[model samples]
Every structure is written in C-alpha cells, then in structure tokens.
Target: MTQSASPPNRALLELPQVQRERLSHIDFKLYFLGELRRTDVADRFGTGPAAATRDIAQYKELAPENLVLDNTDKIYRPTANFVPLFDHAPQRVLTALSRGFGEGIGEELKPMVRCEFPMALSEPKMSILAPITRAIHRNKAVRVSYTSIESGRSEREIVPIALVNNGIRWHVRAYDRRRKGFRDFVFTRMENPVLLEDSPITDEEKVDQDVQWNRIIELELVPHPAHPRPEVVMMDYGMPDGVLSVKVRAANAGYMLRRSAIDCSPDHSLSGPEYALWLKDPLALYGANNAQLAPGYRNPRDDSENKPIKAL
Candidate 1:
C-alpha cells in the first residue's frame, strides 16, 4: 500500500527532508571543487552503494546539465555550466577542509581533508553556551559565574545582547547589572549560567548604548620605515602600494593593532621583525567622541606626542 502511494517517479527535489540536505552537499562538492565522488556521497550520509546510487540518479534526473559521469574515472564530474545550490563562500569551502570546525556540519559526517592549517583548539563547550544563546535570542537576562584575572571569581546577572569575536576569542556584549554598565565578558570565562525569563530587558541595556562598540575607528598603515625588505613585506600581507587601511570597532582596536604588530609610534622607529608595519594616522583610534578610553586599554597616542609607544 505504502509503495503504491510513493512512486519511483518522485521529483528529485521532493525527496525526504534528510536526503535532500545530503544531496546538496554532493552538489556543493561537485559544482564548487569538482571533487564529488560516489564514495563522498556514501560516506557523507553513511549509506551503502544502493542508496547513494539512487540519490545520484535522482540528482541526474533533476539537473542533468550540471554534472556528467566520467566513464574513464567511473565518477561524476561537474559540467562546464555547473551552478551551486548550496553555500558558495570561499572561506566556508576552505574551512570545510579544515575539519571539525565548519558550522552546522559535524566532524563524523565529513571525510578527512588533505590540507593542513594551524588552528587553535581553544573553544567554548556547547552545554555552557546553549543557555546564553537562548537568552540572546529571547532577550532574557542570565546569571553567570565568571572568572577573570581582574576579579578572580564572581557571580553576576547580565542582559546579553550580542556575541562578538575579537579575532582570538568570543565575548558576550552584555549589560552587567551588578556593575551598572555594559561590559565584554569572555565567553569561556563564564560558566553555569541561569537564564532569567522574568527579568525585564530594556533597550537601553542593548548594543545601541555600547559606546565603544558603536564607535568605528580608522587606521591607516604603511610598511614600517624600518622594514629592510619593503617589497617582500607588501607580498607577505598582500597589500598593494604598501598601505593597508583597516576599520575596527573602537573597543577592539587595541587588540587588533597589537596583534598585527603595527607600530603606532609617530617616529616609526620601533625596529624588529615584529614591527613590519606602522600606523600613518597614529591618533585615529583615541578616545571615542572625546570620551575616556575603554577600560584597561592604554592609548599609545596618549603616551607620546613625538614617538610611538614601545612594542615590547
């Protein structure tokens, strides 16, 4: 009875929900990188030969122009006119090959990629982050036991508004009710959060009121006057004419500059392999709207009107 209801002539796109998603990955690998194999489809879905063959037949029925079987290799190859029905971001494709970190795809689901990249292992646990994610979506307050070098350990309730990645780590941009101000709480430092559904969330406590986060600062940088190999420096950073202009939120400007080893010195005299670039407009990231610098951040522009603050 069930077999009669669902005929063999079902539309390719009308396959069951889970199989459609699996086919999309096949489409992505074939169209984007031209490396889709029957084994890739088999491994991706944990299905044997018969099911994978059926999926391929379904896809071929739907889009015959997109892919053709290579009789020589006994594999499917993308046609010249191939178009992607899945994600096409360059970084997304590159990171998928990085293994274990591609969003939404699991480590067990994907085959091991051949390429290697230096990736840090530090990451927050899903259990600790789940409650915070829900609170952000629901506009609810959460209480967390946070540990920081400055405060040691303490419990506080905060209204989480946004999650920010400051290159190296994730931070929660939340209004700290205990401190009566907005603060950046490192995500990994927070533990065992309790979501407060009844707590009143106000617009004033959201990102709109985060002064440093809202302010944008421009940094004009050129090859360090001290860099002996100026041409190599340009190639190293993929910068043309030896100048790179970057805009960052005022709150994260310090971390970005420090990480890039950009000499913020006026004289551009900071010498070493570290100082391969120097800021052209050294004071561009100073106090926002003429207000004080963000907490714990020291402005090099404030220290020396004539020279850059030392990089050591």
Candidate 2:
C-alpha cells in the first residue's frame, strides 16, 4: 500500500504539517491543470465549486502573468512560466533510475527466476483487447475464433462477455453460442476476435460473477536437520523447527504439488506411515505430511484404490 505523510496536529509537528499541506496543494493544482473545468477540480478536492473558483482566482492574482485563457474551451490554463512549478518529469526520472538499479540487484541474486511471464504480441492478440474492453464496458456479446485443446481445431463465433487474469495467463469468460453455456477461452489460444452486432446474451445462469477457480492446499513438511532450508521459495505463512507448512491457493492441485516438489529437500522425513492426506473440503484437497506415524493408525489410502500414497 502507498501512503502519503500525515499532517501533524500540534505546533511541535508544524514542519511536517506544513510540508504535507504544501504537497497536497501542489497535487490539487496539477489535478486542476490536467482536468480543466472548475467542477472537475472541485470534485477531485472534495470542495465546493465556489471554493474552487476562489482558489483559482487567488492563484491567478499571485501569478497574474503566468495564466492563459483557453478561448476554445472558455477555461484558464497555466502558461510556460508556471509550468516549472508543477512539472514532475525530474521526479519520474529519479524513480525510474532507482527501480532500474534495484531490478539489477534482484536479477543478479536470482538468475533463474524471471520477474514477469512473457506474453506474445501478435496482431490478433492486440486486436482482441480493444473489443474485450468495449464488451466489458458495454456488457455486450463478442464473436471470437478460439482453439480448443480437446478438439484440436479452431472454432469460430464464440460469444465472450468477461475477461479474467489467472496470474500466469489471461482468459475470456464467455457464453459459447454452440455449447449454449459459459466457457473460458485462453487469450493465447484465440486466433481471431470480432465484435458481434447481435443483442447481448441475458441468461443469468450463464453469467459467472465469481470467476476465480482456486483451491487452498496446506502442506506440512518435516525437513531433516542435515539439509539446508529452501532459499528461493516464499514462506509467507510457516512454522519452523522440523515442521514447515504452507497454504497455497492454486487452480490446479497437481501443478502446485509438482512445483512444491523442489522445496521438499531430500533429507526431509515423512510424518506418518501413509502420509495423512486430509481433504478439508471434498471439492478441494488440503493435507499434511509426516516423518513418523502413530502406532496402529491405518494408512488413509489403504481403503481407497484411486488415492495415491507417496512421499512429498
């Protein structure tokens, strides 16, 4: 979260308060210049139009020679003489320089990890974004050519209604005209997209408001004393000692399990005879691993033929 410095309440904190007030005034002035109309300026500052008008007049009085009236729009604008006072290009340049230096250090420390995923910029891909944004804004239907992994062929005339990002990829949430229901289309798999002139689909059952399809997995791994701790993995929520556990929300449980294999070092031990894999919610699996088992505790997988009992 980004936060601005708070203003002080007493004389002892006068310096900081004055600095905050000055910064706030500069921000408001820039906003007024960019937005033009006094109504827009007043709306931004949460002040009445009369107060905004008075402030504009006072600003012009202080810098009489630095204000210019826009005849076309019947609005006042700041001249070149006043531009230097509000210009933020120097601050932006400093911010870019700082970010570049920090990214360089991060790249050196983690050579194998890429900061962001690569997205291919093809003409069809670029063209889809505009219509998708428009469809989202207008709440209309869009026709698109999409490829399906199961079908192994490109299908045309799919109606898309929403756009979604699943961290690693982008997808379009749409009502399939052929299937007569909602489906998700991967952006990379879309070949061609065209806006449809037909009326938007209005079936309530087909619209999905909650698009996130993720399940949380809590895994408890006991590391061996000999093996060093995993360095690259993020342990946002964990308990250290011999036991290490994490709550990972994932769209694909198998993919997450495969990725977590790297974090479980060779020296770690299992906690139970048949690792205690408990599914908190039947719809999703949530489980734990153990180094040793309690005597006479039956393996959870023994009764279920489909369940795979294996080491982390």
Candidate 3:
C-alpha cells in the first residue's frame, strides 16, 4: 500500500488582512467582550463594510459569542457584565503574540526583539526552574538533586525564595534543609527537582542576609609586564585605576579565586614583568604609589626571603 503525503505546516497559513481582522474581532468578542456584529467590527478594523460583514459571519462560526445588535445604532456591543473584559484582553493578546514569536531566542536577544525568551538554549539537563518557580509562588518546599565539581552529588530540600540571573548563569537562592542555612544552587547543576506540598518554611528560617553578603570577595592586583594592561584598570563597579581589583560574589569561593589567579598570571607578553607581577595591595599600585614596594610583600610562588624588584 502507498503511504499518503504528510500535511503542510500550519505556519504556512497566510490569511488576508480582512480575514485576520475578522478572526481577531471574534477572539475579542469571545474572550473579552460578548458578541460583535460583522459590519461593526469590520468598520473598527478599517475594512470595507461588505468584507467586514462576511468576516463577522465567518468569525462567529469559529468563536461563538453572546452579542446583541443595537436596533438604533445597528452596531453590536458586549453585555454590561462583559465590559471589564476589554481592559485585560489587549495585554493578553500582546503576551500571546510575544510568546508565539520568542521561545528559543537567547536572553540577550530577547530585549532587542519584543518578546520573552529562555536564558539558555542548551536545554539545561538538571533544571530547577519549574520547582523553584512553583515554590516561590505557592510558598512551599522543593526537593532537589544537585551535583557539583567538588560535592559530586547530593540531595536537599530547600525553600526557594528568589531566582537570580547573573549575566552568565542562573541561580536559585534558597534555604537549604541539609545545611540549615541559605545557599544558592546553580540551576544548571540541579537535577530532578520536585515541589513539596507542605507549608512553607517560615521567613525566620530563611537564609541569613549577612551570610549571603559575605560571599563577596575583593581582590587587588598590580599589572605585571607580561599581562595585558587594560586601557584603564578597573576595580569594583568600573572604578578606574592604574592597578586592577575585582569584587566577585559567588557561592563557590574557590572558583572565583582560581579565575583571579589565572588573570594574575605573569606569563603574558604585553604586560611587562613589573606590571605582570601580582601586588599585595592592588589599590595601592594606582598612580605614583607603585614606584615604591613595601616590605613583607612576597609572591606566592617565590620562596626568597627578600628579592630585588625585577623590571618587566
């Protein structure tokens, strides 16, 4: 037996303006207002009277509405009870339009286009998004299976409070049941998250604000000759200086330290040895203060008791 050809995709449907407008009018009536006559809606949508009338009839079949025809005006209007529906219909329509067009785009591109998009396209395998969102809205607890480079794999129940996106990644800040404190779980590392129906953990049990804030670390660096000298050294918050310092806040302090260590490496050619060497006080290296090195300054790898300054 011969196989029948597959149907074409619905995305190929390109109805004319009159038909589209008529369909929208019917949608407005059914979802927002009551019923609207063909001629009246067509006129509002700037279509010819005859076309409007025909569209109205076609739309009525697709989406039925309880519309009444005004004897004097000959126009149809929604019932009094349905009047408030118009207020929210436009926003709903906009949201639908946005969602229809914006599903797979990256978050950075979402702002350029008029739509909401997911943060990452790799389809994070261990996603905590669903459970976390549910927890936030319902005020419940969530059970999560998490994995990390150091921890390997662990299970914990948490009270999700907020979702955060820090440029490169997404995190859920929650009160960890296992740790008995607040912690951030990287969404990409979460697996098999399930929401609990039990009552929400109280705010008194929430993670301490001080502990969260203490996660931040400030590091100062003086440029070595082999390293690249930025046009202007930037420390925290884009503050310019001759020396570079960075303030990194992360749940994983070791990860941040490793990154800082890499950036402070003295092997790069553009940053001479003098600028490449990591200084004890990155802030003090700014301006003329760098001309003199204070006693007790020592390189982590260097074992010499006192070594003379090496030019880049």
Candidate 4:
C-alpha cells in the first residue's frame, strides 16, 4: 500500500487568518526574491513595525530552519533547508510579480511597485464565475445559459477542465455536453452558472481526452523578410541564430501567433511594421483548428483547388 502524506503544522494552522496571510507573504518573498525585511512586511500588510516583527518571529518559531538573519543587512534570508509555508500557484505568483502583490487583500492597499500596462477592456462577472470555478475545483460539471455569436443563446452542461486567458479575453476550456466536444466558452457570455455536484463526469469529459490541448506544436519564427533592419528584429527577440522556437499547445498556437502579430503566410506575404516575425514554415500549423486566426494563412488544399485549369 502507498504511504499517506504528512499533515501541515497544526500550530501554524491554529494562528489567526491575518497572521497566516502575513507569514505566507514572507514565505513568498523569501522563496522567490531571496530576502525579506520587517519593513517589507509592514508596508504590505499595513501593520506596525512591532506587529511585523512579531509575525516574522512567529514564522521563524514555526519553521526554525526556514530563514536566517543577515546581521549586516538586517534582512531575513532563506536557509539551506527552507520550506514554503504556503502552496503558491505559478499563475498567481506570475500575476503578483507583474501586477504587484496583495490585490485581494483590499483595494485600499497600494501596489508595492510603480507599474502600468494597457488595461483590459472587460472581465468576467463574479456572479457567473464563482460557481464555475467551484465546479472546477471540486471536479464537477456545471449547467449554464451561454450565448455565442454563431449559435445564439442556449442552455448547456459543461465539465470545466481549465480556464484560459487568450491575450484579449478569458475563456474556459470545457467538455460541452450539447456539442459533445471540448470547446472554449468565453466567461463573459455565460449566465446563471449552477454547479452540478450530483452529476458525475465521465472519463470522456476529463482533460486527458482533449486531443488539441494535449498535443504540442513547435513554431519556428524568424524576422520578416520585408522588415527593415532584420537584425534589430533578431536582437529584440534575442535570437542570435535568427530563429525563435516556441512550443505551444495546438489549441492555443493560433492565439499565440495572433497575439505576437506573426506573419503566417507561406510566402511571407503580410507587410506591416507590426509584423516583425514570420512563421518559417506555415505547414507547422496545418493541423491546428484555430489556424484560421493566423494572418494570411490559406489551407494548402484550398489553394490547390483554386488554381486555374490550363489547356493540355
């Protein structure tokens, strides 16, 4: 028989939620950024110097081997045997790094760093998103009223496997019961999402069964032939050999291509300043369903049939 895993530190779990959150913040910075200070904790949590000090001391007491104080810099750095107190997800960590941390604590807490980026025009409604996310977490299906431009409004059941943000918008990758296939449902278009806790999902509805999502496609991108100063393009992409190779899920290849403004025509036909990179071989995307989203791509079979007939 397989051995069961050990439980979390009982004393750590017994601390107040606020203190636990502060400890998690300390662990997050130490593990990722390699150092922490009392002021860092105070600024992030809006706590006094004494409270921050107490929290750090508390964390050290709970995990004695996790950190060591550098007397010269007065900073706490991770020790050789450092272990994280929290399970930080990669997506959450990346978002915090890009946008600044403590977003969920409250709107009053200012970002730790000065940063700016183009604002997303829209977001999914929490009312609809909450239950869908709950279903995803609990491994259950959800019934939803969804609308699509191509098919209009309809009622459907879906087993949500993952959520995807395709540069412009957020969508859920799920097994659509009505269509009997895996489909991307834009989160904003969903309404009245009700988790089907009693409805058991089958093997077919699981993420493993999604072929396009499981398959990986390699894309070889190079500077566009018509681009002025191709060397600058190469340098911008850090491609010393004049090629940037990207591996993406076949389901998301077209989105990645479109988001990067890559020219995907077989002849490098698209011309514009924005088209810095061109797909070295458009055939690499032949089997991708979303390949139509790529700029200037025409199926080879369609091109062959369009050729004008010549006299023998």
Best by lDDT: 4
List TM-scores for all candidates, in order.
0.70, 0.39, 0.39, 0.72
Q: Number of backbone collisions per candidate, in order?
A: 1, 6, 16, 0
Q: Tell me how far the alpha carbon of residue 138 in candidate 2 is from the true structure, in angstroms, after superposition.
A: 1.9
lDDT of 1: 0.71
Give per-residue CA lDDT, model 1, range 132-241, as digits (tens). 88998998999899987766889999988788765677777788998888777887888889999788887777778988888898878788887888888889878987
Q: Name model 1 segments beyond 4 Å from true.
A: 1-33, 38-68, 78-87, 100-112, 119-121, 288-312
Ranking by TM-score: 4, 1, 2, 3
Please write out the lDDT profile of model 2 over residues 183-271, one tens digit for every residue.
56777777566676676556642445322333356655443233334321124224334345556533333334432332232222423
Worst 10 residues of 4 by lDDT: 303-312
- Candidate 3 lDDT, tens digit per residue, 1-312? 111212332422366755664555454554433445564454456668787777656544432343446888666654433322122354555654454323244552222126665555433443447768878887788887888665678887888877765444667767877777766677878888898886557765554452543455565655443445544334322545655555654343323333334233322322332333354442332222112233223344445643543311
Q: How good is model 4 by TM-score?
A: 0.72
- Name model 3 segments beyond 4 Å from true: 1-127, 136-139, 148-154, 161-169, 214-222, 228-240, 244-312
Model 2 Cα displacement at 304 (Å)?
9.7
Assess each prediction's global lDDT (C-alpha) against the native.
0.71, 0.46, 0.51, 0.84
lDDT over C-alpha atoms for residue 159 of model 1: 89
In model 4, residue pairs whose N, Cα or C atoms come closer than 3 Å (at least 3 residues apart or on different chains), thus clashing, are: none
State how far residue 155 of model 3 sits from its true place (Å): 3.8
